[model samples]
Target: MNAQSPKTVDDTRLDSVIYQDGIMRISYTLTKTSKDEIDSDAFTKDKKALAASVSCDEKGLGQFVKSGLLIKYTINDSSSAPITDFQIGKSDCL
Candidate 1:
């Protein structure tokens, strides 16, 4: 899936993609800021919208969601330290 990895998508840079335990894990590094720069409260508040975007997607992500694939997004800081992560599953969408 990560044919062109380590690429920048907006402000985040996709580092790698892995699959294990029926989950597609995508790791991204925020190129613009550090973990401390991100507001935790705002990130938490946007969880639902993020999950919905994945759930309601029609292109290809939704297909993965429907097929019971747990999609995980792991964001790291510019220093390569993990900031926060979340998973979008079928149950999360519902």
Candidate 2:
């Protein structure tokens, strides 16, 4: 599924990058920006800062780099029991 889904709009928030020795760890975060509906025009202006870490080991070392978008949206329906979609873009970084 595309990360641009309505439900994935929150999972693209702040993420964590962990480096262990020559190994690298990565994570992604989804957050709710506001309860208000997002505007198509404003949403198109979304952008995120890509970051990563690598080791200088002589042997093959692990590297971690992430580049993606952070989405924000609200639950417009209270009676729907919350419809959430977790299937978003592939993790091709690993």
Instruction: Compose the digit string of candidate 1's lDDT tens values, residues 42-84.
Output: 8745854676585548776787787798888887888987877
The CA lDDT at 53 in model 2 is 17
Error of 1 at 52 (Å): 3.7
Q: When superposed on Cα atoms, how far off is each prediction in RMSD?
A: 2.1, 12.4
lDDT of 1 at 81: 77
- lDDT of every predicted structure (CA atoms): 0.78, 0.29
Once fitted onto the true fold, the runs of candidate 1 whose alpha carbons sit more than 4 angstroms away are none
Give me the candidate number with maximum lDDT: 1
Give the per-residue lDDT digits (tens) of candidate 2, residues 1-94.
Answer: 1243333333453233444543333333335433244453344233211121122122323221223322222222233222231211114233
- The ten-residue window of minimal lDDT in model 2 covers 48-57
TM-score of 1: 0.80
Error of 2 at 80 (Å): 21
